[model samples]
Target chain A: MSYNWNWDIFLSPTPSGESTYLGWLLDGLQWTLTLSLGAWIMALVLGIGLGVLRTVPNRLLAGSAAAYVEVFRNVPLLVQLFIWYFVLPELLPTTLGDALKQTDPLAQQFFAALLCLGCFTAARVCEQVRAGIASLPRGQRNAGLALGLTLPQTYRYVLLPMALRLILPPLTSEFLNVFKNSAVASTIGLIELSRQSQQLVDYTAQAYEAFIAVTVLYVLINVLVMFGMRLLERRTRVPGYIGSK
Target chain B: MEEFDWTSIPGALPILADGMLITLEITATAILIGILWGTVLALARLSGNRPLAWLAAAYVNLFRAVPLVMVILWFYLIVPTLLQRWFGVSQSSDIRMISALVAFALFESAYYAEIIRAGVQSVPKGQVDAAFALGMPYHLTMRLVVLPQAFRNMVPLLLTQAIILFQDTSLVYVIGLADFFGAAYKVGDRDGRLVELLLFAGAVYFILCFGASLLVWQLQKKYST
Candidate 1:
């Protein structure tokens, strides 16, 4: 194909001599992992709350939850990321805004990315959570309520435990999506895995090797995540439900 | 502190609309090509031939595993060299647009493949058997009996994906193509109104995507009923 494929560039140090290109990629991987994991945690907590809210008997809570999901889910994620990174600071109180604007640039980027990816994914997660809960028989909720549990207790005790297991497979997809979506953080200059690959291309002029390396890293992450989720599903499976038996 | 200076927006609408056209063009091209190629991949995954199925599965997995931004960059950086070498196409903007289009189609195809595969699976086993009983060939069985039913069940999903694709065209901004979001960003940056332009763009995106999803929900209800 006439391409000058140099697999060794990764071993060579950058002109600045601080670290090798491989080290650069590892550094990028660290940020990617941190951003995605933090966002996942946030998405889970918020999504569960909103999802639970959507299914509750209270019209206000359900309507508000639906509103949150629609707003976050509808916008393109890149746009949301941009708003979080570029526009958010301006809307804050002046002193607070200045404080945010003046923070360590990387931290600022990371926080913005975390918030954007977290909330955007929370919207999708909320839908999955709502659907999971809704798929349960009406008798389960009614049974819980009749047995002297409050609504929130019903969720914590009777509803979520069962519904979460039922929805684990779909939840796995949403989890993987957070990792994938974290790549968008690079656009706001987070220097995540994808950004590092772009930097490598600019520096080394080996676009194929750089992108291939990044692609493999991403696949590795996806594989690891799927494997982990599969393990979780097995551990949490109740016999006679969802092919468990 | 002060009210949003939407003053620049009035002057920028024409350029933004130009950018929106590019966005729509990219989205349309990607959906058409992605669905077609995705169906091929779906069928291959369901094919009896082991190696062909494996190859298609591997391709879909690889694409699905990676993020869209990376795919956009991969094509943006990789394809231009080939385009320039073979077609003598050297305009950077044209190359970027083409690369974005290719990237979205290829990436979206992987996703569409999974959706289409699920849709195909949703068709009951008896339909294929009955079609075979009628002496229909494999292709005709898929065409006349299975795919129509599968596609009916899939329309809602396909529309959902298309909305996603429409939203995703914004990711081409990574390559510096002035799609709607990119154009808004450029104007905002130029005018020192990045916040206003971005908020405006977000509002526009919210309205369109939200509207489209509601329509899909209605379609889903109809089909399910």
Candidate 2:
């Protein structure tokens, strides 16, 4: 039962001796960053739109927006990713489906993954945004109305900046969630860090080292994000407000 | 667009029911084990002993940082080999399920620890001091006074964590378990009804999570006020 542990496998060059393991990891890291960034941008935009719709005076718009949030927020992201990648394209019109299928399958699937993750994350974000906005005192909105600022103007000028600050910590955590959830895209064959590590493990048969590397990589990214968000929090912190000590 | 097939559900009911059972089992097991393990880790984390706190911290950090899929795959692929080497036993799917449970429990413990620790900390120091003044032992005070209050305060957060745990059980499918998501995929793959099957899967998840949310809302209303 005595097995030789190969520490060298992680450090030493691969048999091909051309591309370092670090290089492959960096490539995967790049894709992970790309996917997260694209998805976060989409989530923020759509989340705000939906959040505002949910809060609007219009009953129909608010009700529909509420339904959208509930549906998306409740469903698992993996299922959504599967549907977007496997099922949605098939349901499209024949010409469009063929075009999507024929166009670089990897790229199309990657885009779909981004969309699904974005839309799903957006539901949570919408909830956070709505809570952020609602936590504001009613007088602020009333004062805005008194000053003759339109509904959008009041939100843009007074409510949003204040709410953004109030919601920064939760929003940061949501961002972390989006980053972790990018892993789901790997199930559909996206070459993100997790998938790349799996490929490496499959080829090299070094499961432990592969997992350790992936774990370290994820920790590094999350720590970096936590630090960045802390700095942002301090900089944007409202002066008079006291956070939970 | 293809016409909606309401009839397909009746035909698919038995298979869907089977899938639903698997889903319920995984979700229930993960919730129970995850919460139990998480509570222990949370208590260890809050213990004044530095070594115990550090151990709990490290556990939480490692699990929370890595993605659940990686954790599940690590267990699925590596645990069997490790177990065979160490224990001289063959691994089975049940073992894999146990491993998945362990991995998820370990991973979720950190989050639950944080939440529970926050709850414990939020309890007024005066309460503990009063318990001490009344000559209650520390452990008794914690159990009788502090934990109950903290847990009561933690109801909503706990339910939210439950919702998260239920969602995460879907990752078990990677180990070849026929949970709801996997079942839907199997049905779709077999029937060539990808869209219909996916929509149905989405509906199933919606029902579970929505139901959990409603239950949590009721608990919050009952407990918070």
> Which model scores highest in lDDT?
1
Evaluating just chain A, the predictions reach TM-scores of 0.97, 0.94
Please state the error at residue B172 of candidate 2 in Å. Answer: 1.7
What lDDT tens digits, residue by residue, belong to model 1 across residues B85-134?
88786665688888898899889999999999999999999999999998
Model 2 stretches astray by more than 4 angstroms: A1-4, A10-18, B1-15, B81-93
Q: Report the C-alpha lDDT of model 2 over A56-89, residue by residue, as the tens digit.
A: 7899999998999988878888888887987787
Worst 10 residues of 1 chain A by lDDT: A236-245
Residue-level lDDT tens digits of model 1 in A6-33: 9999999998999999999999999999
**What is the lDDT, from 0 to 100, of the residue B111 in candidate 1?**
94
TM-score of every prediction relative to native: 0.97, 0.93
- Candidate 1 Cα deviation (angstroms), residue A77: 0.8
Choose the strongest candidate by DockQ. 1
True contacts recovered per prediction: 0.83, 0.64
Report per-candidate DockQ: 0.81, 0.65
lDDT of 1: 0.92
lDDT of 2 at A121: 86
Count of residue pairs whose backbone atoms collide, per candidate = 0, 0
Interface CA RMSD, all predictions: 1.0, 1.7
